[model samples]
Target: MPQETNIPNKSILTPFNVVAGIIILAGLVITVLRFTKGLGAVTNLDDNNPWGIWIGFDLLCGVALAAGGYVTSAACYIFGLKRYHSAVRPAILTAFLGYALVVLALHYDVGRPWRLPYPIFLSPGTTSLLYEVGLCVFLYLAVLFIEYSPAALEWLGLKKVRNLIVRMTLVLTIFGVVLSTLHQSSLGALFMIAPSKLHPLWYSNYLPVYFFISSIFAGLSMVIFEGTLAHRFLHHKMDATHLRESEGVALGFSKAASFVMMGYLSVKLIGISVDNNWHLLFTGWGLWFLLELIGFVALPAFLYSLAVRERNLRWARWAAALSVLGVVLNRLNISVVAFNWYLPSAQRYVPSWMEIGTSIFIVTLGVVIYRFITTRMPIFYEHPDFRHDI
Candidate 1:
C-alpha cells in the first residue's frame, strides 16, 4: 500500500493559488486569441525571426533544465549512486512535465498546431536534425512517462503493476539517457544550418558539444534547485530518507555541476580558439559572450565549488539558481539574441506580452500539476509495502 501523508485540508484562496488562477485565466484568453487571431496576434515572430521566446526560452531552456530526469536517474540506477535515489522520482516528474509542456509550447509557436505530427508520422524527415529531435522527444517523453509511472501506480495502490515498472528501472534509465543525449545535442545542431545568421562568436562547429556539456550542469543544477523548492514548500510531505539525503544530494550535485561547468567553460574557450575568433572578443558582441561564459558559467561553477568545499547547502542552492539562469541565458543567446545580431534593433524579435503570458501560463500549469501530484503521490516518501524493494 502507499504511504499516507497527514495533509490537512488547506484553503483554496492562498496567494499562490490566486496568482496561478489569474495566470491560467490569462493563458486561456491568449490561447483563444492565438488560435483565432493566429501567431501574429500573440507573437512578434516574423520571417526574419520565425522563432521567438517560445522556441528559445520555453523549448530550449525547458528541455535543458529538464535534463535532471535523465541525470538523476542515471546517477541513481545506472551509476550505482543509490544515495541519490530519493531524488529520482521528483526529477523524473519534473522532466515529464517539462517535455509535455515543450510540446504544448510548440503548438503555440507553429502556424498549424494540428500538423505537428505530420513531419514525424506522415512523412518522416530522416535527413533533418529536426526530425531526429522530434522522434527522440516523442520517444523520450514516453520513456519518462514509464519511468514516472511507478509513483502514480504506487499512489493508487497498484502494487503488482508498480513493481513491474520498478523492475525495468535500469532499462528505462539507459534508454532515457540515450534519447536525452541525442536530442540535447541535436537541438544545438539545429542552429548550425544558419551560420551566417548566428553571430560569429556564438557559432562554432562544436555547438552540439557545447549544448550537451552545458545540459549536464544545467540538469544537475536544476535537481539541486528543484530539491530546494520542494524542501521549502513541501517539507512536511517528505519522508526521513528524502529529508536526510537532501543535503547530501545537494552537495554531491554541487560538486558534480561545478566540475562539469569548468569542463564546459574549457570547451567553450577551445571553440573560440579553434575558430580563431580572438579578435572578436575585443568587440561588444564578444563582451556579451564573455559575460555569459564568465559571469553565468564560471561564476556559478566557483560558487558551487565554494558551497561544496564548505559543505554549505545555502551556497549550493544559490549556485543552482545561478546555473539555471546560465542555461537559460545560453539558450536565449543562441536562439534569439545572437541569432540575428547583425539586424537592427527595430528588426529583432521581441516577444509580445501575450507570448510571455502564455509561457508563464505553461510554467504555472506545471507547478500546479506538480503540487497536485506530490501532495498525493509517494514522490517524497517510499511506500511501506515497497520500502524494501527500493
Candidate 2:
C-alpha cells in the first residue's frame, strides 16, 4: 500500500481543470438560454428524439462507468474477495461522482428541470419503471454518501468517528449494492415499457437481465480503465508503492472482466437465436449489433486474455476502455440510434453541437469532482483500520 503522505491538494487551474471550467461555464450559459429560450433553442430534441446525446452518453454510459461501486463492494465485502479490496474506495468514489453527474445531466435533459424533485414527494408512480429508477437513485446517493464517510472522517482527523462509520459501513454497503442492482437493471426495464418504440431486434423481456449482467462487467472494466488513467496522469500524486500494488487489482479485474464478457457474448447470441433474430442479420441495425458484439465485447475479451498472459496492464487497460466505448455506443444505439430506426435515416435526429458540448461538460465535471474528492480524502493512499492506522 502507498504511504499516507503527499496527496496533492486540489488545484484550480490545471489545463484539464481550466478546460472543464470553460466548458462548464459554457454549459451554464446554455442552461440559462434553455430556461429562458426553451429546450428547442439549445437542443436537437424533437418528439422523436426526446432523448439524445445527454441521455445516451451521460445517463447510459455514466451508469456503466459507475458500475464500479456495487460490483466491487459485492466482491470484497459480500463475496469475501479480499484481492479486490483496494479497488473499493476508488470504485465508490467513481460511482458516486459518475452517478451524481448523470443525475445532473438528467435534470438538464428533462422538459422541466425545475419540477425534477416532484417525483420524490408529489408523484410516486410505482407502476412506472422510471419511478423505481428515481427513487433508487435518490436512496443510492445517500448510501454512497454513507459509504464514503469514513474517508472524510480520516481526513477530518476524527479517528474515533471514522471507526464508528466504518463499523456501520457494511450495512450501507449492502444497501447500496441492492439499490444499484435494482436501478441498473431498471434502466433497461424503462425501455421494455416502450416496446412499440424499440425495435424488435433490441427489445426483449430479458433486457433487464442482460443489462444488469453487462453493467457488472462494465463496472469491472471501468475500474481498470479509470485506475490506469490515474496511474498515467496522476502517478505524481500517487504513492509509488500504492501504484505497484494496484497492478494486482488491475490484473484481477481483467481476468474477471474477460469471464463476464464471455458470458455476455454468449447470452447475447442466445438471445438473438432464441428470438430468431438471425433473419435481421442483413439489415443495418443487425450489422451495427455485430460491430457492438465483435468490436467491443468479443475483441476486448480476447485481448484481455493476451494482456493478462503478457503481463501488460496497458493493453488490458486499453481493452477495458474499448469495451466501455462499445458499451456506450450500444446503449446509445438502444436509446436513440436504434429506437427510431424506422424513420428515414436522414431525419434520424442526431445531437446538435450544443448538446454534444453540454454532454462533454457534464462528464468533465464528474471527472473533476472525482479527482478532487479522492485527492483530499484517504481513498487512494490508504485503507483505514482506524485504530491501527492512527
Tens-digit per-residue lDDT, 1-390, candidate 1: 123332332466788998999999999999999989899878989989999999999999999999999999999999999999999999999999999999999998888889888888799989899999999999999999999999999888998988898899999999999999999999999999999999999999999999999999999999999999998899999999999999999999999999999999889989999999999999999899989998899999999999999999999999999999989999999999999989999999888998899999999999999999999998999988789588
Give per-residue CA lDDT, model 2, range 1-390, as digits (tens).
233333342344568877878998998888788778877999888877788888888888888779889898888888888766667888988888888888888888888877878988997787988898889988998788778777787788887877777787668878988898899889888899787878878887778887888898899899998898887776766654467668888888888889999998888888888889998878887888888889999999998888888989888988899888888877888898888778887768888888898888787787778778776876767744543331
Instruction: Provide the RMSD of all predictions against the true structure, rounded to 1 decimal.
Output: 3.9, 4.8
Q: What value does the lDDT take at residue 79 in candidate 1?
A: 94
Clashes of each: 0, 0
